[model samples]
Target: MTDESESMETTNDESQKPESQGRMQILDHALSQARKKIISSAKLQLFQKHLRPIHKKNPEVLKRMHMQLTKQLDCHISEEVMLMFAEEQMEKILDDLDGVIASQKDNKEEAWRPSGDPQQDSRVYNISVKVKQKAQLQHVLSQLEQQNTLLRDHVALRQKKLLGTKRTVDSGISKWREINEAATSIPADELVEFVQKYGKIHRHHTMIPWDDDIDVLVNGSQKEAMSRALESLPEYTLYRPPLVQWKFFSKNITRSKRPFAWPYIDIFFFGENETHIWDKANRYTQLYMFRKADVFPLQNKPYQGSLQPVPCNSPRVLSRTYDPTLCTTSSYTHKEERSKDPGSRKTVKCESLYRKFPFVFRETRDHYVMETVKVGDCILYQTKAALPCWTESP
Candidate 1:
């Protein structure tokens, strides 16, 4: 009986051995899978950390890739796909990390090679830095130029809309009537002459079919009185331009038709020197040195259905200042011809230079004078009293 019992126990122990071995095998497999998963996760984390800096520094590269993919595939790709692609590429690159490091070190050593002369090396480095900075500045300038071009295009569109509309003849007639009424407010004694009288209402021969702005010549002595009288009128508002010229516009008018189609007047003052009639607002530039008999005398001329004071010798003065044939003709286009003419080239150049370097010139009632002098640059006007006012370059 003791031998049979021992045999049963031995058999039971042998049967339990296979079950325990199977459990041990299952535990070993689970641990192997967990180790592999942890290693993959750590590798992914390392890839992401390395790629983050590259993405931040080279955003345009990603944008270009996205655009190319969108165009090539003819489908919109989400941000996730691009990121996944980048991660895969980064992982491949990191697989050869030792090679990459070796190449980078070689490049860095070559770039930072020191010459025998410290000064020469320093100069080379400075020049390289300056070149890089210049490249960056040029890129910024290109962006600014694009923005400026867009702004200019927008402004041109607005101008086209403003200029395309035409004012009616009736509206023009009404505007002229309003202008005449406003002119009547100025006292007769303060008025000197009417200039640029080209409308149908003037007694003098009309040149242009359409009436433009009215230009009035007032006595230089009585300019203050004229200003006061014009200001007192409720119909007009006074605007002063540079050079002390007065421009009167209708109070109710908008800026869209300003100076050209609006009911307005430009007042120019003239003073007589020893021999010449000088424009007070134009740095006392000589207008004319007329003979005693040819001097302009104030005379009443019909203008806008009202009598206004004007120069009696307007024909003579106009002939002297403008081409008689062109001025008298009803339909003449001289602007293009004048611009192309060689005789006006010098004047155009001087005007352009003056506009470009306004700071270099000083304006006075007597004359326009240059405030600076240099060896190569020409001083157009020089006076004994004028002093050099050269500003240092910043």
Candidate 2:
């Protein structure tokens, strides 16, 4: 009777295997579709193209399939999934941080070790070596403690400065929108269209939080008319930086290059080539050029509770100026060495910027840490890993 019951249980388990496999396949398909959709329309359509035959047969069936797929994708982002993501992220961060600390400790410990064989040396020499090793080990440990303390203090100050910078950025964006609205009356010929550029080309429609400048471009041919219209606006003071061939119009430029200051916008005048539009906003260094077609036929994107003009192919322009990819890690060089020579400005990575102006990129680092530690709050992560012996404790 026991053998017969065991056989029946095995049969039941075999019956469920196919069903489990089928469900997994469906989940895999859903995830693939969702990932493609997030990347770009072209990739999303690549999958949908296979369903063309079904659409031709009956439009209603295709519509239902699309709705079902969309529903599946939406439902996959459940709370449980989010919790799992958070947990995994936290684990990776803790692991990386632990690795860094452990490596440093190992290096110091290795350095403090006595060289040569103690057995082959004299008694007096051996005693001195022991004493020297002891002192070195203690010194190394002391340095490690100081390093940990400095790291903790740096992260705390960064968070505080970031929060303050975010508030200033929020207010600055509103002011930028107001300026955009005020300048609407400028003639079509003089304006030729203006759109958000540089750090403003984010998917969220918010400017790069730490950036203290708003970049915009207009027709270079209409510089005189553009200046006159800008001068008429009583609220803003227009200033052109002295000693440059390119006369870019800047509003309250002095407010920038300082911490927590109201971000000023620069209206760059771009010249039209046969097939490209160019801006020499970087003094005499080089012309920043973009395809005229990509820039023109501008589209409105939602920003700061209002729609604002952005280049049609933001990726095309952004890739040329910043990193090749549309969005990934934030990387751009803000500084130019004018002394290098005309048209020879060197570009620096964002990592260098982080070291140079630590306070400004504080918020970005917080986001990175939060993602790494799988904690939703920056403060919580800081508190969790504040101790010098955090990795050693467990």
Candidate 3:
């Protein structure tokens, strides 16, 4: 039994020895690989250190060395490990390269100097510092130029607005002066007689500065006479409408820029109908009928520093034609006053509608009525009547 046990123990020892030999072989192979990897890393680091000075001058040497190192460490080291070492070596090489470039730049700058005196060196250093400072100043100057350009544009815009306002004011003054001159041209007796025979000057402020077109009214009988009188004047040009009243444009008074185009004075003519006053130019046949005596006996009123003919009962005439509230109110600036004045709001609507559908309806003293034509189907016809009486009072 002892001999059998000893033989069995020997067999077990033999099996254990083979397992230990396999592990030893593995360790030896791993150590050899580790040593090779360390050697390759050391070589790469040394090569990179020497490569910086000649990197620009001898690029072929760097390429050959890179190829050899890659071939030697290809499978011996993991790809990640090799890349990490390569990256570290590359960073060191870049740092050394930067240092060498800086030293070369300094050598070139020193070579350009005429002398190595302390003051000369200080001047060179100051010149470099000033170059940097000049660059900074140039950047700031560019920004300021942009800001200045914007400021100039803003100023130009404001100047344009101011000039436009000035031109408007000057034109308004010139127009007002022309209108005043035209109104004063007519003889006082003829003006008074015309006003008494027809209608008074409406919305003529006696003691205020009026900057609007001059308004005149005449009856059918006086229309030809007034037109002849206006046409006789050298400064006035009579604009005769087909069915409407005539307008008097001033030949002498023209815009500052436009010499041929002139501003005109409005002349309103009224024709008495069965129930209302008809205005051919305004296309409105309906207007409050006034007694001949109510608008007669014209009174002189101050208009732009001159006396002009006005109705004897101007307030009554205004109230009858336009709004009753206008007689009580001195100004029409307030919202409440404007709201109370139907003529002001209705006039705009009527004008807008008239422009849209010019021949649809005719206004009577009471309301608007559709105008009927003698067609087979009785079509509505628009009249070309000019209602100067609808002008708003200030």
Global lDDT scores for all candidate models: 0.50, 0.51, 0.50
Model 1 misplacement above 4 A? 1-190, 197-207, 242-244, 256-263, 274-276, 287-296, 328-394
- Give per-residue CA lDDT, model 2, range 1-394, as digits (tens): 1234535654554454334334334444444454434422322244347877776788667666665664565556544455774776744665666567667874644444444766645665778888999999999999999999999999999999999999877766666666666656565433433323544433333444444345667776766666676667666666654333223323544454532223345567777767877775566225477786666556554455456665656557666666732323323323321133434444555444433221111122321211121112232121111111111234
On TM-score, who's better, 1 or 3? 1
Order of candidate numbers by TM-score, starting with the best: 2, 1, 3
- Across residues 1-394, which tens digit of lDDT does each residue of candidate 1 receive? 1234435644554454334334334434444344333322333233335667755787556545544543443222224444664777744554466466657875644446787899999999999899999999999999999999999999999877766543444455566566555556766644555446322212222213232445666657776667676677676688866576677776776665344224556678767655445457665345533332333445454443345565445446555555433322323222221133354222222232333331123333233223332123555333221211122122
Tens-digit lDDT track of model 3 for 317-384: 65665652222222343212123454443223323232232122334333322233222334444322
Better of 2 and 3 by lDDT: 2
RMSD each, Å? 28.5, 23.9, 28.7
Residue-pair clashes per prediction, in order, are: 0, 2, 11
lDDT of 3 at 371: 31
**Where is model 1 poorest over a 10-residue stretch in terms of lDDT?**
384-393
* Alpha carbon deviation, residue 94, candidate 3 (Å): 44
Q: Estimate each model's TM-score.
A: 0.35, 0.37, 0.33
Residue 231 accuracy (lDDT) in model 1: 71
